[model samples]
Target: MPSASLSVKGRISMINFNTMNLRQENNIRRRFIMKKAARFLVVILSMMFLWGCELALIGIGASVGVGTYKFIEGKLERPYPIELQKAWDATNTALTNLQISVSGSLLEGAKGNIEGVRKDGVTVYISLKDEGQKVTTIGVRVGTFGDRIEADLVHKEIAAAAGL
Candidate 1:
């Protein structure tokens, strides 16, 4: 029988089946979109967390390529294979070697901050964090914004002083 000539009950059932199918389709589409969005979010968050993670070999006089450091968000950071105390001492020696007069410094427990100014009057900030197991992470920032070259130079000095 033609759908148009179906009994009232039959017509209602047919309409309900179509409506159900549409609802199921919409739900499936929503789920697909949600899955894609979730995957995209995961990728973006991973990238953000690994922003300054670059592994480079450091020879006797190698530059900052694939070095044990990173420059992210105006901070050139690195995880040195040394303890906090040694890293702090290295930082001081590095500054002195570079003639960047230390204006202020604070070393407490496993964390430290050193503020200095280059000869040209550019402000420099360095932070040290202990990662346990005799590992320390150092972050360096130059000036209000960020100077990659200057930061690298600072890191080189620190690394040399630390004997890394």
Candidate 2:
């Protein structure tokens, strides 16, 4: 009888130990899963936040008649619904009107660049690419880095000159 009692007690203790280990293991796995979920959520939210400005710009451009543009690196680019030749001529006129002295220029069949210097000695570069018929995209940059105000001014002048 005594031996039987000791064996039963040992079995009961083993069962308790096993149950405790299982509980602890389950808790660790739950915590790991929770941590992963939290990290994923943070990454998703951060991406959305980063894209907020781009989305807003798209919406604004869509609302306006001017198509969407992308500011890449230091260049602010825009598209005009005009022929490449028209756009090129308008660019020159715009720079001349803006009092930016043309330093150098190049015009190929589908790509071209116009470099000039403002009175303030800030270098301005305007690049043109033919997208399709009556569609030309222009990328403008001011100085070595970039100047949004100057770039925008250039774009605005180009648009006006192109009758866009």
Report the error of model 2 at residue 98, Å: 0.3
Those runs of model 1 whose alpha carbons end farther than 4 Å from true positions after fitting are 1-66
**Per-model TM-score on C-alpha atoms:** 0.61, 0.62
Worst 10 residues of 2 by lDDT: 57-66
Cand. 1 Cα-lDDT: 0.85
lDDT of 2 by residue, 57-157 (tens): 43432243345677788899887777789999999999999999999999999999999999989999999998775667799999899888789888989
> Which sections of candidate 2 miss by over 4 Å?
1-67
lDDT of the structure predicted as candidate 2? 0.85
What's model 2's lDDT at 111?
A: 94
Worst 10 residues of 1 by lDDT: 57-66
Give a tens-digit lDDT track for model 1, residues 2-79: 565789898899999999999999999999999999999999999888765443222222232226565679998877
Error of 2 at 84 (Å): 0.6
